[model samples]
Target: MSLMDYTDQWLSVVQPQISQGSSWLADLRQGAVEQFATQGLPHARLENWKYTDVKALAKREFVLPKNAATQADALVAETSLALDGIRLVFVNGLFSAAHSQLDALPKGANVLPLADNANVAKTLLGQVAAANFSGFTALNLAAWQDGVVIDLAANTVVEMPIYLQFVSTEHTDACLIQPRILIKAGVYAQATVVEHFAGAEEAANFTNVVTEVDLADGAQITHYKLQQESVHQYHIASLHVQQQRDSRFTSHNICLGGKLARQDIQVELNAEGAEVNLNGLYLGNGRQHLDNHTLVNHNAPHTNSNEDYKGILNDRSRGVFNGRVVVHKNAQKIEAHQSNGNLLLSDKAEIDTKPELEIYADDVKCSHGSTTGQLDENALFALRSRGLDEAMARGLLTLAFANEVIDRIEIPAVHDRIELAVAGRLPEKFNLKGLV
Candidate 1:
């Protein structure tokens, strides 16, 4: 059957569940699903999705997760960062108060489940504009049941980071889960957030997530995402961010698992002096496929944006990176730079990277470039001459190539976690601990 047919079937089955909400929300959901019906899953025919096709996602019959509760404590412990902070846990896309720490938040900080605060959440939901998003985004908007909301008061500085954990359990039948997150930073406020997606080792599931962030004037936020789903799972996520005058936003994305995974990040600088920085790392082995796409809009004068993404592909794994930066008219004095670099460890591994810059303002300084190649033979030879074996030398070089992006992570625990995960993906013959 065609993807549209599959989508229609699923929508029909979930219509009842989607209808069990406030009238306003129900109307919003209906509108979003209607939009999805008009535009099915993005295909290779679409320019933005030309490399990573979503048609394969329709082959599997995925049903909404059953209400049956799964033991998530063990899973959370295994994936824990061990950082001291407020932790919000979601099991199979439903909020788990038993595992979450929501009490005694910093003064002026408000945290709650979106379902519990629908009246307030409604005002913030779908506020950020994502004109080029695909049908998955609409599906997520229509189907998401519960998620987290964070709001910070003006001038508040949250020293401790916030951790949002999502765990998917292994089910007998393939299932689907959609989680949404909304974060609003008040003027002059500063905060950090970490989003973690994990699942059982061999679960066949599909996870669709959407996150919206709004940063007011002088606000700053550091966001991080770590995707470590099962090799049999499919994961797709979208992040939309809007920045006001003199605001700053940073994102660090680390993708370590999933048979097929894709993430889209879009940011808009809506006022002068707004700044954004995006860094990402994805490692794929076996038959895995990972794709990262990003777009930044420089809509105001004196705004700046920097983006760098790196990929490591081994075995027959495939990777894709597409980044675009647009400088709008009258948005002069903008400085934007984008770079995507890839390292192929095996001859069969493949990578496709494209960096695009559309400049309408002549005074803006915008540049983008992409590079994909195997390990440097000269560096490998030098390492071998230093008494290191071929495998060890290659492992060290590969780790170094990936570290250029990891080292940019400011959080020590996050940096360590990413380092460990990358080391585990290397060949067993190479001892990467010492090199890191």
Candidate 2:
């Protein structure tokens, strides 16, 4: 199928099935659909999508397949972390309340499905994550049926982190699943959120998602994303964040699986004293392709941002990293730093890394760098001389290289999970399972 064919099918079959909400929402959805159909998918011709192409995604036939919610419940039960927090589950883009745990919530907070909370949804929907960010984002804005809406009251503190589980089943083949996530933090509020995306090994699901976050003055939010989807799946997601005065926002993105995966993140510091940090790790092998793109805008004085992304590619896999930091005019006293490091384990493995810095202010400090190469042979040999075999030594060296980002995770369970996944990506002979 071609791009037009898939878009026609979505508009004719899928759009009519989802219940039309209020008049304003209906208008927004209508406009977004028109925008997506006209513009189509992002291609290599576009500078932002030059390194990563989505022609295949545009050619695939998109159908809304019926999924068995029971499988998703079982998947969440087996995969979710054992944390003391509220869990929101989604099965093939539909909300699954049976498996969700929302017994307790802070007073005056709105934590529910986005469609269910019309009052809060109307006030902020499409306000932060504008539709023109990308084609997939516009499509998600049009077809997002259900999503999580988190609205915190002033000075509120969520003791436990929130868990969001999105699972795809074998029945999700050739499906078009679009989910939206909207988070609003009140003044001085604090919260942590973890988002996990995965699918059945047999399913070749297509997931297009958008997450919008708005932080009020002095609010803090830490977001952790773990993407371990099926190797046959195609995943595209974008995160848009807006920070106010003295607000803080941090992100940890771990990408481990997907046939063609791309992630786009943009953060805007709109007020003085705002701060942001972005950390990411991606591992690929067996012909997988992973792409990560980030942008930080220092729109106010005294703002700060730090970004670090690492990639490990083996076999014939490929990786791409493009990070840019912009210090706007009059944004004096701003400081921004960005770095991308990659390790290629095979001769055929390829990595394209570009770090860019745009500074219009004279009194600002900004720096960006990118480095890509093979594992340190000297370090490997040093480990070998300490009585460790070649395979074990190689595994140790690679793990240590990736651990620079993993060690920054404060949550013990998340750190251990990432460590285990990193070790498992190594060759079979390099057995460093429990050592991590």
Candidate 3:
């Protein structure tokens, strides 16, 4: 059957439980479901999904939660990822204040659920909750129960990092979860936020997530996303960012989960002297697949951006990276660079890297490059001669290859934690001595 048929079938299956959401949101969800049914999942024929096949992943039917009270302990327990920082917890896409802690927040920083602060956040939330996004986003807008909203007052510098976590625990059946997040950084403010998406068990599940970030003039915000889900599940995520004049923004995405995962990140520079850095890494094995698509827009003069993304594919896994930079006609003196590198550990594995540059300005400097190849034999032999075994040598070289992307991260603690997680995903027998 076609993808549209599959979407209709699943929507019909969940139609009975649509009323479980808040009564005020029931109509919105219904409208979103209808839009999703009409739009369906993007396929290889679509321009945006040409390299990634999302139709196959959309064939399965996921049960919606019966209520919000189930799996309360799991959500509360997982909220400790940020011990000294503000924390927001979402369980199966339902916000839980009881499990969240924000008492240590800075004087001017505010952390609250979108549904709770509905009066103030509702305006911006509605403005950003656009329906023109992908089918997954449309579905999320319709059914998302509640999500975290953060606001930083002018000139406030939040010392402790804020962490937001979306934890999914399979109850007695397979299910789907949708999460939405909104962040606003005031003028001249500075802060960092980390988002982690995880599943408690390996089960048939799906998660659709959307995040929006707005930074005013001279504001600086660093954002990171870590994706680790059940191997049998599907994950689709999109992040949109807007920067005002002289502001700075950076986003780091780490993908290490799901049978099929796709992420799209976009950043728009609206003022002169605006700067941005986009970095990402993905690891895949078995028959897993991961894809990253990033776009950087230079709409104003004197804006600058740098992007680097890498992936390591072992076994029969596949990886894809598409990085695009666009400089408008009036965006003179813009400096932009992009690069994508990949290592295929096995002949059966595949990596597709594409870098595109579209510049309409005469005085702009833009460049992009991509490379895909196997492990270096010379380095492998050198490590083996130094008494390291084959797996150990391979692991060391792999970690070092990913280190180039890791070095771009500014936070020390986060850098270390991400490195450790990536190392653990390598071959079990592999060892590391001089790799660090």
Candidate 4:
């Protein structure tokens, strides 16, 4: 129970309600509670948290909820996963503005609601995530309870897609839902941001989130993440990106629910002709535990990066993918690619895939790969000679191997709500996408 008594019972109940109106946000929340009492919670003796273990979720007994004990069905369990632009609602972690809708914001867009604009992100808020980046980003910058301060202006183009909905309920005590998101994209601006995390199915809540994105020069950003909470919730998230020159960043991560889910994606292209794309998909059945950790740093010089991640596991579920790509040193003519693929379909399902490439540039074009198999026993007996049974031929080849990361989701209602939440986490869900 010690990380200095979990940072003194989390700053004696979140420092008098969100560090009272800024003194540089009370020194950035007391320097992230003294760096979570000097790097404490993040177990598996950390090698990038070696195969994800949170030591029984850092020995439970947690708290830091500062009001949001809401639940008269929490607006029918968060509008059954609603989506239709510019919507921001957070039930368990404050900020609801009666289930928000910001009147289609524009005209010098600055999507506030970080409880009084969080001092307008005092110089890019913690300058792209570094309050000792871990131990849950120092307990989400030491206990955050509300967020969303996106300031895009330069050549502002919003065209919808700013939805951050986080809802959790049923907490008798053992709460912790931290949300801190700050996005700043100006020069040549364009945006898309969607993050949906749900809970309340016997909510054993704990969602620690941190998102910081700043891309200026030639700016363009698209990030979508959906982590379906409450398999007995506990989800950890982190996405930190900083890019420049010709900047363009894209990421789509869909990890269905969590008994224990982890996502840490860090991208730094720096300048030159920055470009980054990362697409991921993780689905697991009972005994669920999904982990995805990605790091891409080209550091300039005609930089371009692309990564793809996919995983599908059934019962006895376990999946982890660690993808890394580094091309620094002059970064000469850089181009990096990484891929991790897994499909285990229960033979006591399990996957621990890793794809890494570190090239100290020499006119670089780096590549990384990892693959795990199952299905395709001659295309599942050729779809059982075309009559299509055998659980609809392994759910149409596991939804065509998860439609290769859901056919690069280009927002058709966030791609049919991620193809019906990855076909309702397939365990033979019939008409999986209704006969395609």
Residues 1-436, candidate 4, lDDT per residue (tens digit)? 5334455555565565556557887777777877877776766767888888886776676676656634524543453455665888787777877677888977767897786787777777778988787877876786686788899989998988888887777778857888889999999999898888876778787888889999999999999988888788889999999999998999999998889999999999899998999999999889989999989888888989999999998889898999888888998998888888888877998988878788887997777778787777998998889888878788888878888888888877767767877886787554665654
Between prediction 1 and prediction 4, the one with superior TM-score is: 1
Residue 424 displacement (Å), model 1: 0.4
Q: Go through the candidates in order and give the C-alpha RMSD of each one to the true structure.
A: 1.7, 1.8, 2.9, 20.2
lDDT of 3: 0.79
Task: Give the range where candidate 4 is weakest over 10 consecutive residues by summed lDDT.
Answer: 69-78
Error of 3 at 193 (Å): 1.0
- Write down the TM-score of every candidate: 0.96, 0.96, 0.90, 0.34
Which tens-of-lDDT digit does each residue in 1-436 have in candidate 3? 6677777776775576455455545666677788888887776788778889876777766777545535567644653353466777777776766777788887888878775664555545534445556777776766665677888889989887788877777666667776678888999999888888876755456788888888889999999888877677788998888888889988889898888999988888989989999989999988889989898889999999999899999889999898989999899999999988998877898988888899999998888898886578999999899998889888888898898888777777778867877787776767653355
**Which regions of candidate 3 are displaced past 4 Å?**
7-37, 66-83, 126-129, 374-382, 432-436
Ordering by lDDT: 1, 2, 4, 3
Once fitted onto the true fold, the runs of candidate 1 whose alpha carbons sit more than 4 angstroms away are 67-70, 129-132, 376-382, 433-436
Q: For residues 149-185, write the lDDT of model 2, one tens digit per residue.
A: 9999889898778888888777635777787899999
Model 2 error, position 319 (Å) = 0.8
**Backbone collision count in every prediction?**
0, 0, 0, 0
- List pairs with backbone clashes in candidate 4: none
Report the candidate with higher lDDT, 1 versus 3.
Answer: 1
